[model samples]
Target chain A: MPEDSKRPDEKNLPRFRPATDILERADGFYLYLDLPGVSRENLVLDVKDAELMVSGRTDYRFEPEERLLESEFGNVEYVCSFTLSDIVDAESVTANLRNGVLEIFIPKTSKTIPRRIQVEYQGE
Target chain B: MVIDFGGFGRPYRLINELWKPSFLSQQSLAYPPLNLSENASAIYVRAEIPGVGPDDLDLVLTEKNLIVKGERRVEKGRYFRQERPAGGFQRMVALSAPVDADNVRALLRDGLLTVVLPKAQPKSPRKILVQHG
Candidate 1:
């Protein structure tokens, strides 16, 4: 696979940092990224060494006969990264993209979750 | 505003949080960035609107103008970083050429909206050969 088409990483074009929201829960963490114009096939996600990287590219190709009158969006890329803690179980991470938004699930280890400890009636 | 992650402080750090390029900063707030184009037979309009469904969008096309209105709703939750704004927006664009109102088509897929309007009359040009007198 050619290095250019295979990966979402692009250096020559302009890149934008996607607007993001990170929600935390006892069970796991949910990350939402607004990546408009990026298709499912153009998204790239990687988790390595406690770091999560997300990159997406949008392609805007005009036909030969079409003439652009007004322009705002063009060929651009979206990139955002996050640093995960040790408690986060990287192997179980999962993600999905829908309606141009990317959702990532980062589950933590069972030991990290706060739990109620059952105590015997030894005080009685 | 930044929020703490489970009271353990903000574990997630965005390295590029302040690295916004000036060229696109103003364009970001202008919701639903659009592209208007036209060919010999039809006009095209495309808008990038993520997280919005077909029901949330309303489009009105007339002889000389096109109006787009839509709402983008974000789920309520405890957010550590909230950057994507959620609200309703309306934008009106002027059409360069007249179009067939009855034949306009709108399609939504993966958060991109594409509208095609066929021209009122076919503008295919013909070459007339000049004969020697």
Candidate 2:
């Protein structure tokens, strides 16, 4: 289903409380997400308008008939949202998830870049 | 040092001293391994939070500190005895430098949480050109 059509009433839905880092460079920005237990298989990254959506699930439960020893953790899931600023180039955004970390790179718009003015040299 | 109280009057101090090491050991054992570094521009934190999902974690930022809290729910299988403590935990740290709270990011990879905190604008480096005579 499209992320924009997603209403507030989805069950088994991942909850989002974003913890993101923004690294500004001469040309762009890097946004990193701490989404643990999320695999590349279950991870979803979506862009809607100026908002970025990140959601996933972590499955740790085994078969019911299996022998159990210790258990403190329950099922795992993820839900986080980011509202990007105008400086972000939404079209150029790219995301990658490796070893549970989700990294999104957003290149800055041309307007955000500093333009250098040419210096004129007059012949004496 | 050993102090024997009469009959059932065991020295509470003695019990405390004896169990102090044990209690310390349990706490040390329960704590996750963590490493942190900071510079004028940002603070970096890495924590080992294995088998936990994003929903199990919480991140908070205050005036001078950042807190990471979450629960690790270990699954129980059949025919086994449970021993390890599960549920959740929390850790708070005072930052080494003032950060641009508007631009903080966190990533979880391979059971590790990595946070990158950007420093305020004034804390950034200024380029100075040298003029020679």
Candidate 3:
């Protein structure tokens, strides 16, 4: 069925919530999202107003002549967002998509990193 | 972890439930989502599987059923949110009709696994001629 033919209430198709994993390390945080069938061209990643948003669309089309016996693979659009904290340096964040998985690295500022301090005794 | 005891222990159970791995759920353990389509001479089955490589998949085809088995490994990381299940899966799909297993072609692309099974012979509707009395 064509998307436009659907009623207004159904116009917005169901979006798939991609499962994400967030790991906090000493230097920074790493974010991973499982997005199968999504290509690099279809992915959109942006940080606006301290919010990190990731979205993508999967491309799967069926021929008109094909008869569907059973259907479970529906059209899915991936959408997820997270609020970034002050410690995350959004400007220096990097992302890479490989094998249907996306990985984002958010580096922390130098001030947030822990540093060791040494003290010398001055009393005799 | 701090335990909450004010609300009849409901919150604690919820937290404990959330901590469990999602693959333990019955729905996911049953089978992965699949779609089946057929045409005049072939049957096509598509399964939605993300983060699984082609090498990890194992397939067994018979005249009546197609068994798909594979595992999606959990990547090494500290997970803040884990919704997608990571574990082994086995699904045996019953074919509507007998198929030629030798001619079956399977393709995995974009995390969608599609198997095309050709029929032994094309079955076409026959047109019978009307006899005049």
Best candidate, DockQ: 1
Ranked by TM-score, top first:
1, 3, 2
- Lowest lDDT 10-residue stretch of candidate 1 chain A: A1-10
Per-residue lDDT for B1-133 in model 1, tens only? Answer: 1122222332222332224353245543477777788998898988988888988999998779999899998765566777776899988778888899999999887778889988898568999999999
Q: Rank the candidates by DockQ, best first.
A: 1, 3, 2
- Model 1, residue B130: distance off in Å is 32
Candidate scoring better on DockQ of 1 and 3: 1
Q: Where is model 2 chain A poorest over a 10-residue stretch in terms of lDDT?
A: A1-10
- Of the true interface contacts, the fraction found in model 3 is 0.50
Model 2 Cα shift for residue B55 (angstroms): 27
User: Per-residue CA lDDT of candidate 1, range A1-124, in tens?
Assistant: 1123222355655556777878776667888888877888888998878778888887555556887776656666777778887677888989989888888888877766555689878775
Fnat of all models, as shown: 0.61, 0.13, 0.50
lDDT of model 2, residue A41: 77
What TM-scores do the predictions have?
0.75, 0.40, 0.72
Best by TM-score: 1
Please give the TM-score of chain B in predicted model 3.
Answer: 0.68
Better of 2 and 3 by DockQ: 3
